[model samples]
Target: MTSVWVGERVRLRAKEPDDWEAFHSFEEDSDAVRNGWRLHPPSSAAYAKKRTAEEAEQRPDLDDPDLVIATRDGNVPVGSIGAHHSDRDHGTFAYGISVGTPYHRKGYASEAIVLLLRYMFFERRFQKAEAWVYSSNDASLALHRRLGFVEEGRRRRSHYANGRYDDEVLFGMTIEEFTALHT
Candidate 1:
């Protein structure tokens, strides 16, 4: 069996088709596209397949990062995480994660982020990790800060969401910074 990323409360492993079945959009307050976290939900299975293919084209040297977060006890599908735009030459990557509505506040997302980062940094030998989140996304902002991602920059009023423009914040962490946090 392939190795899985196990954390205190969650496990990061291969995404099953069931995971896609359980996949859903965020709450009204957290509409991913408007918040600038994603472009749109896959329209259909065919579209999802095509999207995956295109993503593979962009990341020729790498396979898809299909890490799904599930409860360690029952292995119930809760969310998905991906490390995209990976630069093996530079040992850097950008990542995004999505959690199902039913899975919120169960610490699934929190543990998944930790496990994914650990796998990327230690297992994959990555040096730096980055993510973009809207400044209005208090949950994400707080999570990134708590996880040691520093604010690298910001683009004010760059994204239009919820009938108004919201600022996009860039957060990043280096291997050194990650080590300082975990060690």
Candidate 2:
């Protein structure tokens, strides 16, 4: 039987000690970092390796730990996805996703999202999912729209990037909507 974490082209897996290379490579991609989340100073390869090990060890304690997005065939690391700001009392959560530059538009990110959403809605019992997108990140904005997430609202000029401020667009979807569309 197919596993819940397994999707058409990608599978969600726990972070490994050896995943440092992929993680570090992602940090080097300025566009990926800026679009996916706020930019920060570059990190050293040694730091990335240490951070991956530490995070892997602490995964069990996290309510929703980050998962590596790997190709189904060779299990090659392509990106990462994770749920955050989970409010168990309110049955709501938000997630962030980042796919490596070379792997863009290959459907890996979409399938990884579907896998995560299914697990969150069905297994974790989260009623709603939300995503925050930067106005400058055209790819993420389009991806969310294509996945059926409604444009809930926008926090204007809240995110500063590239020496300019950009609006943060909020997108949301309920379990009912997810079921109707995905099931």
What lDDT would each prediction earn against the true structure?
A: 0.73, 0.89
RMSD of each: 4.1, 1.2
What is the RMSD, in Å, between candidate 1 and the native fold over all Cα? 4.1
TM-score of every model versus the real structure = 0.79, 0.95
lDDT, residue 24, candidate 1: 36
Q: Output the number of the lDDT-best candidate.
A: 2
lDDT by residue (12-43, candidate 1, tens digit) is: 76655444445533333256445435455346
Residue 161, model 2: lDDT of: 74
User: Clash pairs of candidate 2?
Assistant: none
Model 2, C-alpha of 82: deviation from truth (Å) = 0.5
